[model samples]
Target chain A: MTGKDDVATLEEELPLVELPLDAWHRAKGARMVGFAGYHMPIQYEGIMAEHAWTREHAGLFDVSHMGQLGFSGEGVDEALEVLLPSDIKGLKPFRQRYSMLLDEEGGILDDLMVSRLGDGAFDGAEIYMVVNGATKYDDIGWMIEHLPDEVVMNHMDEQALLALQGPEAGDAMAALVPGTAELLFMQSGLFTWRGVPLWISRSGYTGEDGFEISVPADSVQLLADALCALPQVKPVGLGARDSLRLEAGLPLYGHDLDSRVSTIGADLGFAIQKRRREEGGFIGHARVLKELADGPGTKRVGLTIEGRLPAREGAQIYSGANLVGEVTSGGFAPTVGAPIAMGWVSLPHAALGTALEIEVRGKRIGATVAPMPFVPHRYRRAKS
Target chain B: MSRYFTDEHEWIDVAGEIATVGITDYAQEQLGDIVFVELPAEGAVFEKGDDAAVVESVKAASDVYAPISGEVVEANGALEDEPALVNSDPEEDGWFFKLRVADASELDGLMDEAAYKKFVASL
Candidate 1:
């Protein structure tokens, strides 16, 4: 629902695929919609109610459509280091870092999570990564073409990914898996549940305490049922997920982040650690370095509108008749009780507290650049 | 007052020349969680099939077209603060606008309550 602006292109003649939990979702009375080439559940009861539930309680999200990739063999770290901007060579086992794939010219190919795994872990994958579903195929192809032949890549197509997110997620998880409470943010480990092996990470898209569990596709139904059985955990659909992430100020890959957008321009420069920036070996390093030295032409910033009208994606942003930028993602943020948005505007116009206008229904609504996480992030980190 | 439904799922309760317009329950359910509604100005004129009010849900913004030509007499302002009325009572308290009927003959082309129920079944 975050990218409904681009959903028209999604309904092309391309056939829709069914989810592994297609029947489970339908049985729960979910409203199925074609998204990312799959018939996925957009919502169950109602979007607003589901949005509130996630902020207050645990929400189980079926994010299996994302690509879970496993890499092994010789020079695996070095191979990935050449493709991503993050310092993969420095990654510690059981640790996860946000990274992005870039084209030769430094255009963002896709944003992903890269994790170093323990020996012979998670299907013997030395390195585990998750990429956005809409751009997964292209990412796989790009990596395959560039990676050394000795380094092997496995697309875990038969695996399903689920995210249990919210302030209550930790308590709910500890009830199900005892050791899960020990994990700090950006940490992960392997565990077994009811004889099924799971690769879980203490991370999520929503800026809330959560875990992303990787389970075999065939066993997803059992896991989903068990999670939802907990009084604190409810089955949430993509609708709530979209709203939660938006309120958290996280970008949806296809809509907010795209090829034309650079990491610095998107305010993702933190992904390029100091080591990677100093070494400059990854693809798109030139642009990253250039943007670092000379600031990106346009910068992504958060906006708060004056009224209730939501300015959705593709809505043009203006500063008194001058076209400055366009909305990348936006909606009525349930937690804020008002409309919030993220858009890329020229550096001069992207400053905080700057006045702007967004054209909705041919009328420009007043807006102001604002600091984000429009709702404060409630991530639980390791005690100092 | 006679209630007539349009193919687009708008309902009109005709009482003499003045009629109340609102989206059907089915339309509101499909839109999902009414977040905002943009109403047309009172005394605004419109022709049949012209763009009118917009109903925005958490999902998407959908246009509720002018099912028949008329001049707007009044718009339900309560929706400005509480759009959920459209979801809870779309036929009564959820009314969008009132139109002074341009032509009563236009109702002949639309469906009655019974016909609309059957049409909904076919879909």
Candidate 2:
């Protein structure tokens, strides 16, 4: 969020890398900022304008900075279970699930999306994973060092990731690739367009019905241009992307989540499959089970401030004069027309409607714990 | 009346002992969209370079520093209802507040219009 191009490698003096769409974003007058290790477009037209566009129309986002990886060969699921708590072995082909990578102490290393690639796409590749851009190198190295030698790990660094999200996303995607509207949320496939492979998932972080298209680096501009040409799609920047995810109550890797945060305290218990919870085989399983049995010491909760001022990250949460917790992510919610935040607090002070105070710029602002997803999710779930 | 600019992108139009303050067009443009404006209460005293106001956009919030030591005389309450004014007409009706200047000499230290233009170009 600072002026530095990349904080992750700031001390190392490594150069800030650019995405394949760097020129394209600049052409659109995007205001680029240093995020993770990449120079990403924070906004173009404007944040409020782009945020409203995504809520009403289709907004295209360049998330190629995320690390796209593939794992294949025998015993892939068994090997993956050692790191992730999700039900990887039971994942149906072309289906995706949300999961987290945990440390030996049960603290989260990173949150990720794991999808089982359909057999029709690649004959050998079995599992597809996407990790945060900042932690990807370490994730790859960790997997390489831990997994059996028979399993092959492929980093699809040559690809660009794009998210076309909003209510009209289905219409925009179906315009380019027919039958895309039929894909339900969490479903994915390898579709061909203009003779190029497009790995698409009917899912996104905005809590909207949308598609995340993964295309070859060279073909990305073409695909982006085609999508933007549609009446429903417009290029959105990281500014709106962050606001949308904030409203959706989704946690960001380095902000809302970190190495010291457990899955339970992070409010990500859903990522742990029931079978994994009962069997207790994954890394940090004992700690997670202990929290599940005797609640976490602290828990993540949502806060709605009483005034217009935002209580940004690092703001302390106070109940009377006692410090209870600290805010991880907070900002004005464009959709809700108020300020919203997510933070971790002791279990006793984490209840909904618990009145608390957040100190912003040395002033205490009245706030209360509220239900999350300030804007209800509009995903296209499977037909019941 | 003459206008003075600060390195932080704040502008103060001084007339005798009173100064009208607001952010420059460049600051508003850099901020993207202005959703909320936090103004200091009337009669509030501030030192030169103290954070006197805050402007928040959808992406992030930024503090507006006082260009000179002064006591806030009036706050633009219009901003509370329509903060977008700061984005539309930043120099005029979008002014943030009025201050009773504590020392008129502080205005001499600020950049003039031409100097500020050159300074901004350097950034």
Candidate 3:
């Protein structure tokens, strides 16, 4: 739903696959759609209501379609640094970093969360990572082709991913997994509930304090039911997931961060550590450094739409009749109570408060470049 | 006066030369929450199968096509503020626009209520 934009390419000849909790989702009255080759739920109650629920309370999301990979063996850190711009060697145990897999030309292939497990844990895995659902196959193939044989990449195909996110997420998680509330932002740990092993991270894409729990596929239903039964928890679907992330100003994979886009132009230079930027040893390092030294011509920015109508993907943006860029992702922001959009624009037009125009249905509507993260991120950095 | 339905899920209530057009209940349901609707202006002429109106949900936007060639007589002003009316009463007050029928013969190609019900069931 986030990274994939190729709905027309869905191979109707190929049968859609069901997730581990497919029956449970149907029983809960989820409106399912074929997304990323899986019959994933688009909404439960409705997109607006579900979006509001996640901003006020806890909402559960089934993200099992994503590919989970584990890497182990000596020299794994040094090997991973060769593919990513992040300083993988400096990653502390139980901490995670946001990084991207870059093509040799410096374009991003996929964005991922890489977490180093506590020393000598999870049998042999020194690092565990989660990649976008649609690009996981290619991401794994890229790593297998590049990673040295000493580092063994294990694909956790039999596991399911669940994200419990929002303001009340801490309370709901604490009720089920007692120690989860103590985990700070970007930290992860191994835990057990009813003897089912879980690898949970205190992180999410919703710009809220939450946890992404990885559990055995067979026992996901039991885990989901337990969480949903809590007072503040409800099952949400991909519809809300997208709207929430958009409000948080996070980019979707296929729409905003395609293979042709660079990390510098995407305004994601924070992912590269200071040491890595100066050292320049990772893939596409030359281009990244050049772009860093000399600013990118076009930069990604947020837009505040003037009218009620939403400017969706591919809508043309203009600066007084001269086309500047196109909208990447946009919709009615339920929480912000206005129409907001994100797109890439020319450097001159990308400044905050710069007035612009968006042609929706041939009528030009007024818009202005605004600061991102339209909704303030409420991440809990430490135990309160 | 008889009611006709199109495969695209639009319904037309034919009364003499004026035809009341609206999407079926199934379509409003399928579209989920109706947030915005772009109704064609009065006097706008549309050919059969031309894009008549636009409907937007929280997730995506879709086009409502004309079932028969006609000129728009009036659009439902009530929907400009209360788009959810399409979800609540799609057959009655949720009507999109009134089209002054260009050719009554086009009605013969459309399915009746009974046929539309069966067509929907087949889907």
Candidate 4:
């Protein structure tokens, strides 16, 4: 249209906040998109090529938008245990576990990673937690209202998080920081690089073996430059990140799990250990126990579509004549070489090997409920 | 024979009463790494501006609209197993379908190569 029309469109748009590496991504030819109140890279070269590169080599990701929280002071473990379903009190030093913040009704508020830090990390902060970026502010407010005045919560807004993931991630890290590759899966330790302290964990969302490194916001650009200079490391974007996690059978918050969905229905009961289940002191323990005794009416399951068209979010799922479920996420998987999806379906229709159909653009495509992890994981775990 | 393009980015190469249709190279560049291409069945009839096919990438699925009123004569079969062909050679071998002309006058509203290039630059 006219120049006036362009100005009008710009006036209606919200101002997106830039992350620490916003300029770095733009300089490297990344396609930027508005996500979680920030300008983030959606892709660098292309999604398929980047996805393949990550699985074969190492993919570096800028995840500073995620919330990094540190907790300490009196009874921090017990305080967190009251809000989360995981066994926080028993978590050993230098160990991390996947946990979720649930409402009193047992609905998930946000899924997070909780790690017990020894004197080796973050100025002796007893607990470290990482939450989804979109829901971090809400999570913080909820915790402030629930937690006792004695325990202190520090939002590490000055720290930037990065993930170096793939089969060769260890080699890349070992080259940069000596002895860092000795950590096993779910292990974390404080390390130094060029005099800058780093807290690194041998865990990532992708099913591939990898590491997540948290560094100071000021040093992030330097670290990103150094890491990418390595032949094994390439910068990846959000597009491949989503596809890789989906193939790993990991659920993303806001899409797959929300305030209306229970912990048990998402098949995340593993996060709720036996001691936490029996003790039942958490906010959502009642619903968790009830769902455990009875059954969650709907359960999330993986689906393999038998056609070309992808079943996107909000697509209806059908079994015979009845509408049985809805797809929360679906796309063409580069690793699987087929269309794969995750959906919430009625318990009766959620069993593996169940025949189903997905309605895409008014056409029904054949789909079958299949076991998750469409691709196998390659995490480097310690031998027993 | 000359090529005509529509605002929606579909290109039509008209020769006599038979025309080959596909997306413009610019269109394929915008939709990166095509994972699938859903074409209309042969003998399918449609008026201009109707949805004729769907091309999907890793993150999104976009619809390809018919440039002019026509009847489908043949559909592209090479796209099913090798959708990346659309990304590689969208203007030539990656043609979507063939349509028998239903109304030749509809081509009057289409853009020629020079006009289409200028329009893309404006965007």
Candidate 5:
């Protein structure tokens, strides 16, 4: 089976979301590759150039293929609580929470964003969520089986998502929407630009201050073109997005957190809310809570290689002579100007400042376990 | 003077006893943004078409082969820090090593620039 198909089989089956600029990507000489079921641009110019461009300026990305769903009706929070370990009922409006879709065995199926949408003109008491593109259909399938009939889940397939990221992203976005800079990190609100309604979220996978604008699919091309026309924004592809996330020390769903890995072992214990830890009602809550109270046997950690050579995913990680762990994600970090990686290692060796080594093509290259966010995050937050 | 190429895309230029070895420009482009080069230790002997060095790119790693049987006389230490030189000047500054040609007749069996170009196109 093809790599994409292998992932597709593991996910809950759902329809694929096509972005507005799908044609534009093909016309730009982008190499369309299957990712998360959608034909996405892997590269346009080149991986290196695209990676550097995103780090220096702004990259306009079409992430509309990701699943965007909304839930409403009575006891929506309580119903969601049965599936996720996060305290969704306590989430305030306009605020977004990062949580995982876990299996009964305490393994992560997917990581998703859940936001409480306040009462709107059309709907009252709703919850909006965006899930990973590859696992969205499976995530929806899992939710359907668990959600009570009263809670209606509406798939926002009519919408398109765009991410504009980099240091100059805010300035460029502000010029278009005028007040987008006021949205703090992880906060979303409805706004209109030139009469096009948009749900703008101040967040991104890259460790840059950026916004994810969800707009009607029909108007996606116009919005993307408008953003690209700005001096700071350039069309970026999947190649740079992968490299940028690697540099940011963020996890890729399949490679980093999979059905085989528990949330605590993946260094995502912080995502489990304190109330959930105590109430212990969600799926896999017993194992997760126990691991939280004690600790996981292995943990994910950041790694820095000694030289220019990069350690790719699946490379063996070692502590001196012993095989301790394996590299989950790794690459040449564009922002750090060197090679960096994230891998899971034995709990004792996963701590920051711990030294380790990776065997690359038979040679044991020296590495050190370091703190995550290898580059400090520059996300835009509200001033105190 | 004679020119030879191995299946791995490495080319050798031989004159009497001394031989110059480097990867073809096509090979450099395929590898893309070479980050590391592991050259053979000087004085190491190899038969024709034997793996001699390694060139690593951001996407993958490739092995360089000996186009003609020889003993490594010198290596490119500069590539340890600036492997991009291979992409920039594959024929000149990016030459991997120099060797003492062990079997002069091996050079006769390899391809010239025109033949090598045609061979690459076939791929």
Candidate 6:
């Protein structure tokens, strides 16, 4: 069995990177906990309060520890296509596409954002990706080995990432950088705000229209402080980030998606482009395509509890008296003002509106499989 | 009027046969935000250190132990809807229950207010 000694030895050998706001987080009386290989704030004011605040108004998050890498050079799209199942050739510049890094058996290693960068045109030198923090090192190492010699991967360790999210995030961000409101969802660009260079993308994980700003490490504190000064913005911690994402119906890395689970089973088959499905070149394409065609035996679904009582992760899900599945992520959704959860169940019980039961503290609580994005997504779409 | 604390951080005010029960301020702080409280049914019999109640926080769930053996005569049912009261007024309005003491001598085994403070500080 892999024990603490093994983990400690591995950690000792591996390099650790600290985010720019490490000191700031410590100063704020944050309960720092290790997550995804970095020490991060689990809560400051408190989890529930922060979670509720993010749902109602803008919440500033220091997500600098997430892996940010850029790929450049000739045939970068083709090089990327070799690893990811997404159709990179058809991707337009400035537009970000949500894709996955899959393993040989078609299980997702991590879900990531891939943006083609270079002034509205797909230049050969277009930059390609951002992977999850926990799997970044392994991902980089894997890519370096598999990627063609001509393509160069640059890990953006010098940059710090911050997410400003919620209903009022756009207005708060636009006030800092002029004309920022004009940028549509999934579109990113280089802009200068308060003398700090920022690569801002109007995308977030909280099912809200917001910006994920990448700035130099030195200027990150200044930018975060400036944004925090806004009326709608408040510094949020990782605790809120987890609850918000759970409410948003987004899957977490280790809990929701892991080496044991497939993308089709996770309800993320939409990430696989149609052409890629036909051509079948990426890693684990055969197994993934088969799962896609045959339909998965089990699937992820949302559950809404009957009362204010929250069912937590590892809680057994039941269909009548029989055990059907297990709750992977569950919590009190601050926005919906109710308890919500997500879990994996048999394909027959995975449909929306299917009634289920969650065993909370040994008592079966009434639950129903509900459609996700429990709150409607407020992404800014391009004008027709 | 003398206050005593159990090793589990539960505080009690013993006055003859009746004893007031509540968790310590340090316990509430460590638990973060309290969202739900499951009170023991009124008149339930419990032994000293028995799991008598439950407090659910955003991050975790903890069992509130009975400080001394007794019959639970009254439970704070108001905590059902507003568990935050524990954080706001844990000592007064946030008290969990009142127990009819089965053994008055049990109070001698618990630490007094000053001793409890020193005990907490030692941790």
Best TM-score goes to which candidate?
Answer: 1
Residue-by-residue lDDT tens digits, candidate 1, A132-221 = 988899999999999999999999999999999998999998888888999999999988898888888999988888999999999999
lDDT per residue as tens, model 6, A347-377: 8898889998999877889999999978888
What is the DockQ (computed on Cα atoms) for candidate 4? 0.35
Candidate 5, residues A27-135, lDDT tens digits: the string is 8777666677677776777677877777778888889778999899889999999888898989999889889889998989999888988637114548888899878
* lDDT by residue (tens digit), candidate 3, A238-327: 888988999999999988888888999999999999999999889989879988998877888999999778888888999997999889
Per-residue CA lDDT of candidate 2, range A151-238, in tens? 8999999989999999999999999998687899999999999999999999999989999998999999999999989999999998
Candidate 3: tens digits of C-alpha lDDT, residues B1-123: 789999999999999899999999988877777778889999999999998898877777788989999999999999988888999999999999999999999999999999999998998
For candidate 5, list the clashing residue pairs, or say none: A12-A137, A12-A138, A64-A161
Q: Looking at candidate 4, what TM-score does chain B attain? A: 0.98
What docking class should model 5 receive?
incorrect
Which 10-residue window of candidate 5 chain B scores lowest in summed lDDT? B56-65
lDDT values for all models: 0.90, 0.89, 0.90, 0.90, 0.83, 0.83
Model 2 chain A lowest lDDT segment of ten:
A1-10
Off by over 4 Å in 1: A1-9
Location of the lowest summed lDDT over 10 successive residues in candidate 4 chain A? A1-10
Flag the better candidate by TM-score, 2 or 3.
2
Candidate 6, residue A282: the lDDT equals 90
For candidate 1, give the DockQ. 0.46
List candidate 3 segments past 4 Å from native: A1-13, A119-121
| Predicted candidate 4 versus true structure: per-residue lDDT over A104-200, tens digit per residue | 8999999999999976577788999999988899999999999999899999999999999999999999998977789999998888999999999
Model 1 DockQ class? acceptable
Ranking by TM-score: 1, 2, 3, 4, 6, 5
